[model samples]
Every structure is written in structure tokens, then in C-alpha cells.
Target: MKLRFGTGAILLLAGLMLSQPVLTQAQRQRPPEYREIMQAGRMEDPLAKIKAFEEIKQKYPNSVMMNSIDYLLVSAKIETKNSIDEVVKLQKDILAKSTGPGLITDYLTVNDQILRHKKADSFNKQKLVETIKKNAATGKKNANDAKILDSVPQQYRKRYLALSSTFDIQLATAYILAKNSVQAGRYLATFAKEGGTKDGEYFFRLGQVAELNGQKQKAFNNFFRAAGLEYKGADTKAKALYKKLHGNIKGFKEMLEKKLTELPFEPKHFTPKTKWQEKTALVELFTGSECPPCIGADLGFDGLMETFSNKYLIVLEYHLPIPRPDPMMNPATKRRADYYGAQSTPTTLFDGVNKLGGGGGKGNAESKYNEYAAEVERIIEKAPQVKLNVTAKLANDVVTATWSANKKLPNTEYHFVLVQKQEKYSGGNGLKLHKMVVRDFTTLDTPMKKTVLFNLSQSEKAAEKYLHDFEDQRGFKFDTIHNKIDRAHLKVVFFTQNKNTKEVLNAVICDVKK
Candidate 1:
């Protein structure tokens, strides 16, 4: 009877141990460690924070604190050059655990960051909007819960009303993500009537809505109103845009007339030298083959290329791999897209100085493109402070590039870009497409001597050696590999910079096919 009682006691103890919730490493570890790492993250030492969070995650995968730690882990991963998909997957994992409000807010913030990183589509944007609305509405309905309602900001009352009235605006922006300008326009009109205010932001949003809807007159009017507002940033942007639009109509018409007669072979010859010229019109088009609206602009770009030939237009298409499969996407492009704070697809940047939504049709696009082109032409007319020359050569799997500039500028950041031209391939559209896509970009340090050479010969050789050794040793090949050799078309693009001011001095694109 004594032995049996002892055995029963042991069994009971085991059962209790099994029934109790498992503690994660984060739970087992000192809480001070987590606090320290979080503080480090606030200090911008993300790598340190990542190490701390990783230790917590590895030790305590089942702790209640794991949810918050996971969110931090995602942020740390993002800081350390990990893919947004990886960060998002972790967020989803934490969300599955039914975390609390703080964790939920962290999840939402991370989701927004990931969307900014990867360029969310219309469907994704709509899903996010719906989720936000649902959360907000649920929070509002549960106002009796002081704890929940107290967590919400007092400013949210006004924001909620604004959101309610401008729900269609959010939806329209989502449509812009979907590349459905027609729906976007309809929604924008609704938002303008219901939510439009005299605030600069309101007019700016209206202007964007009108621009996307292809209502140039309305866009101009809204922009004009926004420019007249007393706000600083919005007013400045509005004024610049207003002047650009005011001048471009006449300039584009003249260019069109000249093109009709001459059929210019290059952009340099066709571009006129005018005092209004700003700088190299750096047109960065964030697009994807899977997006329908992008297809229209893509066609328009093709036409522009044909008409302008090789003229002064330096267009770089950054294919954002989102919402659909895009094997051609480089991680660098996604990083730059995130850095530029792009929220949706079909976005364009002119001279890296101006950003425009890509919802406009042929007429609107032509006007805007021409306006930008005329500005570029005017800038080039004045002898540039720096003259850029680029040379590109590929040997085996290595690409080497050299950039030479004539004059140095203050407060600039230089970037070297590799571009490749390939034969057009299509998916069911029956139209072939030629693209000048960004292959890679290297951001340089402050103004060095005018000449810079980036040689990847050793790196290429090392990669080849590794691959050959792997095949010989294990008879296995990695599924992912990048060999920059054997590409039929290649180009080099150079940009001068003012590092202190973070401004681009000038940008030049050179065709290596010549």
C-alpha cells in the first residue's frame, strides 16, 4: 500500500507538469534582457536587438512574451536585410497565437512595413483597410471597456470620422493598387464630395484622385488650391507640380510636332535646351507584368521609346515582385522601392525628384512625361556640373563597371546601376515586350576622385569555385544561383551625388550594346 501510494503521487506530479502550459525561452530568460534589446533597437542598433530577440525566441518559443518578441524579430530581420516575406511569415505565425492588443498593434505596424517593402496590391490593400476598419469599429463598439478604449488615441475620434467619410478614398487608393483607374476615379469623386476639406492634405488627395481619373483640368485645379494653402511640404509640392503642368502643355505639343516631322533617332538630339530644364529626367517606373494597368503605361512607354528613340529620356523600370510571381525581381529593387516609400503599383518617379501615381491614361501620361522631358532638356542645356561616362564589361559570371565624372558636387550620394535589355516575351497578350530593367545597384560613399571602378571578377571566380566544389564534393547543386554571365544585352547607368544633402547631381545611361 505504501509503494502504491508513492507511485500514485509520482503520477500526479507528472500529470501536473504535463497540464501546466509550457514556458518559452523568453519566459524562462531574464526579462531585463528583452528590455535591454528593445532599448538597443530604439537606439538604432538593430543587429544587437536581433541577437537578443533571437536568443529569447530560441529559448522560449512558447512563452506569452514570444508574441511581442516575434514582432521585434520581424523588425530586426527587416533591419538586417532579410526578405519582407520572411518578416510577414513570422507576423502571421504570431497572429495565429491570438496575441493581445499591443502585439496586434505591432503586427499591424509590421504588416504596413512589409507592404511598403514589397508593394501591396489592390486586394492586399483592401484586406488591410477592411481589417483596420473592423478593428476600429470593434474598438468603438466596445467603448464601455475602458482598458480597450483607453489604448486608442484621443485623436482617433477625428481620424475615425475622417476615415468613415473617406472610406471610398482608401478604396480608390486600393483600386490604384489594382490598376483600375476607372474604379479609382469613381471612388475618388465620392471621397472628394464627402470628405474633401480645405486642408492641404485634402486638396492633395483630391488632386491625386483627379490625376488618376485622367481629369487633367480637375487635377490642376485641385493642385492649384493645395498650392495656395499655408502648409509647408504639401504647398511646396503643389507649387512645383503646378509650374511643371503649366509649362509642359506647350513644350510637349512642340516636341510632338517636331517628332512628326523628324522621327528623331535619339533623345539627346530631340531634347531642347531651355532655361527651365531641371536635371536628367530620371523616370523610375515601378511596375509588374502581372498588373493590368501597368500594361497600358508599359505600352505607352514603348511608344515613347520608339518616338524618342534614344533621346534624353533615362527610364528605368523597377519590376516590383508582388501579388504575383515575378522571377525577374531582384531583392535590391524591392529595397529601393521600400526606401522610396512606395505604397502601391504603377508608381513613377521623375528625376528621383518627383513621384507620380501611374493611374493616368495616354493623354495624361503624355502630358506628364513631356513635362518631365522638357524640364530635363532645359537642365541639360546648361553645361552639367558633372559629365558622367560609364563602361560595362562582363567576363564569365562577372560584371565590371567603371564610372568617370568631370566635376564633383557637394552633399550627394552616387549610385551605380546595371541594366539589361532582353527579347520580349509575353503571357497570352500576344504582344512582345522589350524592357530596360535594373539588374543591380551599388550606392557609393562620399565624393571620391571622379573615376570609380566596380570590379566583380574575384567575386565571380569565388562563386564559380564554390559551385564547382559543391558539385564535386556532394554531387548536389543549390536551387538558387545568380550567374551574370552570358547575358546578350547590358548597360551601365551612373549618378553623381551630394551626400550631405542626399541629392543626385546628375544621372546618365550608357548603352553597352553599341
Candidate 2:
């Protein structure tokens, strides 16, 4: 990300990197004396930048930079992954001196990063969680008061409200990351009790906590509840546990499914929109047919597609090699999984940024679907700064594609892919239909051209490979299974993403010629 720019270019770039419209006028101004130090502070290497800052501190103890040096020092320490205890002390010092309660969010963000460190256990988890609660409370109060809310700028106001809404979940997760599962459970329970989180994912988490605490009955109850809630991984694990504890619950799973279905699944709010790709959303589904935990993804994604077809949502279900093999599973699936850090079945990504769906069970399937739907609805409304002009055509076995932009794109990379609208693969779990299946990938450096060999028709080798994926997972419900690829069911999915940030800019589903 480093570029060698001249003096004028560097000055222009600095404006894009640092801004403080929310701060007071005086705080926003950079003193002339700190110019060289500021430039050195912007070095790419954290340790080298820290050395530059330290040099400034030693050279001018009485300088004006003294006032702001602490913040810079702390930022550097975090950038260098300094000791958690020392960083905690420095961050707390910054918080104590912070005149604005909302600024506590900066410290919380640093602490959250520190908490992510595997060996970072120096700070008290309880104390840190409490501080987040206090900040969240203050943020709520400030956001609710007309005068106080008006005093803050719009961007900071939005940030404060967002942090307030998310602090509890972040704090609970931070505790778990710090290896303080006991405190993590306590905070998560308190969060749920306070009506802070309602996603069925919380129930799966509670089950995990119960298991960690050796509360078998409580754990089983939570896991069992999660199974019917529209989470495949949780349901899979719950079913396994249920069978082990009380062999063949007969109609137990069926009864749970029936009851869940009987419940009214009404979304509180959703407005159907016509326009989709001003900002398109991608659902990267990590699943395998052999993995029973992926059933929820199958059902839930079906619901999503029903709600928003190729118009607003583009689905890519990657079959993985886990627990057992899936014939359609390929190296690309594993590569993408590794890139996304997906280690378990039923993991999904929204726009390659927000991750959702995993674990053994879902506490509420209908509710989870609504949550996902709401996100898509929100994305569908966003107006994009750049629009993608992408097209794909298939001829023989080779596919050619072109991607261009109306204007300069906002940090984007071009990706061309092949997708199947439907494929039939009945593995151990006996799934009959797999949709939005990603078949192949090709990368493009610009909005120019890229081509990849596409499998227009299924080969016997493909069927043989498919059979090999499930040779050991014996007794699939179907006595005879056919593995074939249908070209008529295929299309090309194109993606434009922030090359550095990994954010999807736009996605298109283009029909392929028969």
C-alpha cells in the first residue's frame, strides 16, 4: 500500500488519511512544529514510526507536541502489538484525560484489538467490560438528548450510536477472546437478559458456555433449542448429542421442525425494491452436502433467494471437504475458506466482510432469516460511487468476459466466475438441490478482459470425482445417484471489490448462452 509520492502528492494524500471534523476547531488543527514528526509518524513500519515519535519526545520535552504525543505513542504501540499491560495503562490514561465521553470509543477500539492478541491477558476482563458498558450508556444518553445529539456532527453521532448498540456484543466476545470464558458467559447472559441481543446465535453461544462450565443438562437444552432455530451447524451437533444421550428420538427432530414451522414467521419490516446493484450483496456460503450442519444454509438461503432473486442478491455456495468429502468440492473452495478464515460448516459472509452463520444450532430460524433479510434490504438502498459494466459470453469450452467502469472505481478488483443455478448431488445428508453453485474463477487486473476455461458440460471424470467424494459416507438414502452438470443451468457471476479492503463494490449475474 506504500507509494513513493513527491512533496505535493504527499500533502494531498495526508488530507485523505487524517481528518477530525468531529473534534473542536483547535484540536483539529495540526501545529506547524509537528509537521516533520507527523510525516515520520506516517511511515508504513510501526516500529520505525514509534522510533521517530520517541526521538521527537526526547528532542523537545517542552514542545507543543507534548500535548498530543501520548495519543500518537499509544497508537504506535498498538500498531506494533506492544505488551497488553503497558498498552492498557496508556489507553486508560488517554481515556482519563479525554474530555468527550464519546472519545472513550477510541480507547475501547484499541482495547478490543489488544484483546484479540492470544497472549494478551494482562488487563482485567471484568474491568474492561464494565468500562465498555459505561461508554455505551453515556453514548446512549448523549444520542437520545436533542441538544447533545445536535451538538455532535452527523458522522460522529452515527458512530456513537453504532458503538452503543454493539458494545455489549463486542465486550462479551472480547472476554472470550481474552480466554476468560467465565466472564464471557456472564457478560453474554447479561447482554441477552438486558434485551441487547436477540439473534438465535446467542443461544448457540450460551450452549457453548454451558458446555465449557460442565453444565451438561443446560448445555444440551440450549443446543437442542438452537437446532430448530435455522442454524445448521448447531442443529447438526445437537442431533448428534441427542442421539448419543437418548438414542433415536424418533419424531423428536420432526416434531421440533413441525413446531418451528407452525410458529408464525412474520418479518416486522421489509420493503421490496426494484433496483439491486447500486450496491450488490454477496452471500459466500461455506458448506458441504455430506455435512448435515449445512442443512440450515440450504433452507435459509432458499428463503433468501425467494425473497430477493438475482435482482438484489448473488449467492455462491462453496462446497467444502470437511468431516467428509463432497464430489463438487474443489481446491478453490478450500482456498476461499482459508482466505475467509472459515474453519467450520455453515459459515456465511455478507459482502465478503460481515460473517454470520456457524456453530451447532440456530435458536430461531425465522428470526435469523429476518435479520439477514433486513441486511440485504439495507444494502439494496445504498447508492454506489462507481458502477460496473460487466458482461460474459460462453463459446465452446472457453468463456470470455469484459468489465468496465463508468468512472474511476473506488479501490476495486475484477473477478469473473461461473455459477450454476441448480445441481443435484445427494450425499450422506440426501440434499436434492444445490443452487448458486460457484463452478470456476478467473481474475482480472482491470476493467478490461479475462478468460477462463468453463466446463460447459459434465465429463465422466467429473462424475467419477463426484463418486469419490462420498465413497466412505455409506448408505445415502438414494440407491442410485447420477452426477452431471447442466450447461443450461449455468451463468456467470462477476464481482468488483475493494482490492485492499476486500469489500464487494458490485456484483452481477449474467446469463450464459446455451
Candidate 3:
């Protein structure tokens, strides 16, 4: 998709360029000249495209689309210029002006292009790798800045993460090409310790590192796993390595087939201690089924469930119609969103206050999972200050929840939620199954031991009314109706929180038995 800048953005760009003092008269006009930019992008011939883009760059020197223009111009030049030096110079110019994800992307592009140029001597390769590494460090620094990441639109976060992942793998390959085996192995070890990418290329690189370190058995195992993934020439390398290690390649193909059916490689991470925690951590995810960015957050939540037991963690997903209409949205879900003051999809709150916003696409799921896993571990280690428990039963379309707490502090509120264990819906975001969806909820100003009965039949009508009101208020259309309740698969959640501080004191989840 093409990124267009408005008058304000162009003016901001102009302000940032004022110190350059080399702006053309046309650039000083500060006009929105996106049409010319799009025209350049659509040019058929490479030379023509390069000329058009160069002209656009000269005319709209302060355009926010300067990055896009430079990238396109470089791409066109790659097709027309036979000199590797000129291509390298163009990429270097882009790298100089780029920051954040753009810098990382351009670095990856430059490094990959350099690698593909077989004519490049070792000295040139070393120089290029050094430049790329220096710029990659800068990109990482900029990306680590909270303000920079928050400035990015949530939907674009996925693309940024994917680019960063590719940059990381490419950086490792660059070190290996430079014959810095020590650095490559060190980098791969650190990445693995932090839960590295799940791609087969990672394992292939690990195999190379193992072979370099003289661990032939380990190298064979790594190559076998990489070959199982069928990544590029890993199968041939795995066969050759197996023949050298075991004196035969007879069982190599069989091993590869068996490994193919197994789960992908997962690096080991420190598991958090959960034996003595007094209260389980509560993680609430606010998401939209039609929102593309929520895919990573949704999958990350599923990973959290697999990684931690319910005795240590309890999770709830609240649906909202954000960026697009979602079928899973309802009144209670909207109310929960308001309670947390959540304004964006894929926003996750840990214990009510530690809010992590922005998620990416499916390719970014593993990164997001690692991020959440780290936070959950940190939060789980906190000493418990309150004790809460809850139980519930489902019978004749009625849910009875009994609750008790050690004590309730001032400005504290108790919340009871009915969660559907799982729901199936073919949503716009391509998610087929949604878990732990909030079907209904209620809040009380004070806490007390009592039995609350919820009639599913009445709640269903209320859900319909809520949907109708939401449609009228927002003037939005929903693609499908999803108010139906599945009583057979449901759970009840009880949580208490400080209304003023928004810290969840305690929480518990119980199955709704019929």
C-alpha cells in the first residue's frame, strides 16, 4: 500500500529539512504532490521509472514519501545499473536518511544485495558488513525508543516486526560471510536464549555454527532438523553431514519425514516459579476479529495458555468493533473495554495496569509471545496481597456464581464474567477459532460472599439490544449476528480490582458445570 502524507505532515517534514539549506524552490512551496509520486511508482520501464522517481525526489524534497521514492529509485537502478559500486552508494544514501524500521529494512536490503554480488572481494564485503552492522545498531536503538514505536500505527507493527526478524537473520548471515564465525555463533546463541525466530533458516545457521565448533553430532542434529523443514539446500547438506557422521545416509530421508510431522524447533527459556503464588495473574486482551494486527496478539494469548497453568494465570478476551466490524463484539465486551479505557484492538493488560499496545500479523506471533511471556514471568513473581476465589454452575440456561474474598479495600470493585470457552467464526481477520471470549459480565461497587444467578435467555436479548444500539450509535454495519450463547462450553471468572489504581488484587476462573 502507498503511504500518502497530508499538508500537516508535509509541513512537519519541511521543518525538519530547514537545517539542510539545500532545498529547491519547489520543495519550499510545501504542496501535497503525491500524484507525481504514485505516477512514478506506476512507470513501466526501469529507466523511465528511475527518471520519474528522481524528478519527484528533486521536486518534493521535503515530501514524507522521500523514503518510498528512494527505495523505488534504488530498485529501478538495480535493474539498469551493472556497476555494484553505484548500487551500494544508492543503498548507503538511503541508510543515511532512514530510521526505525525503515533503517532496518534498508540495511537488510543492502546486505542481501551485497551478498548476491559474487564479484565483491573480501575487503569490499567486510567494509559493507561493517557499514550495515553500524546502521543496524542505530536502527535497533531507535526502535527501542518508546516514542518511536508508539508513533507507528498499530496495523503497521506487524510489518515492522517481520522486517526486524528478517534483518536479524540477515545480520547473522553477514557475520558468517565475513568469516567471523565466533560472532555468528555468539549472536545465534544470544538470539536462541531470547527465543529466536522459528524459521528453518535459524536451524540451518545453527548447524553451520555447530560444524565450525567441531561438534559433528550436534551439527548433524541441527542439519537434520533444518532438512526436515526443507529450507533451500538444507536437505543435501543434512544428507552429506549424516553420511560423514554415521557412515550412511540410508535413514536420513525417513528421519526427515518424521521430523516434518513434529513441531517446529523452540528454544528453551527460563520457566517462572508458580508453586507459591497466592493469586493468579489476570491477563485481559482487547481485540477485534476483523482487525489484522490482532492476529499476533490472539495467537500470543493462546501461547500463554499453553505455557502457563490456570493455577498461575487466567486470561480473558474482550471483542470490540475496531477498524472494522467484528461478529464477536457485544455489550459486555464494550463495557469491559470502557472499564479499562481501551481504545485500540490488540491491547493487552496484565493485572489491569501494565498495558502493552500494538500487535502485528501472524509472522510476528512468536515475537509477541516472547514479549508477553517475559511480562507474565515478571508479574508472576510479585508477592500476592489478596486472596480471591470463585465457583459457578450452569443449569437450565442459568448460571449461578458464588464468590468470596478475604477483604475488600476502599475504591475497589468486583467483576464477574461469563466466558465462552471457545467460539467458531470465520472472521475477516482469518481467525477460525476464538478462545476465552467474554459472553457477559457484571460489576459491583462492593464485595461480599453471595450467589449471583445469570439467565442466559435474558442476557441474549440484552446482547441483541446492545448490538442494535452500537450499530445506530456508530453507523456501522456488522456482517453477521453472533449473540447466540453456547451454554455447554462456558467458564466463570471473578476478579477484584482497585478502581482508583486499576490494579487487579486477585482473580480466579471456574468451569460452569451443568
Residue pairs of candidate 2 with colliding backbone atoms: 226-362, 229-365, 233-360, 234-359, 234-360, 234-361, 235-360, 235-361
State the C-alpha lDDT per candidate: 0.51, 0.60, 0.71
Cα deviation at 313, candidate 3, in Å, is: 1.4
Which candidate number would show the highest lDDT if scored against the true structure?
3
**What TM-score, to 2 decimals, does candidate 3 have?**
0.63
Kindly list the per-residue Cα lDDT of model 1 for residues 1-514, writing each as its tens digit: 0011112222222222233366676555656455654464464566777887787777766655554565556656665544434545655553454322332233334334443343354235555555534443443343334454344445332322333333344455455555566776776577557743234434555677677776766776666554443223444454455556676444543533342233112222263535523345456778765564454455445545654434355667776644343334555567668867765667776566565554322222333344445554554565455666677666645566667766666666778777766435443222245377766667777556444443444434444554455456665553443324225677777876554543456677766532
Q: For candidate 3, which ten residues in a row score worst on lDDT?
A: 1-10
Per-prediction count of colliding residue pairs? 18, 8, 0
Model 2 local distance difference test score = 0.60
lDDT-superior candidate, 1 or 2: 2
Ranking by TM-score: 3, 2, 1
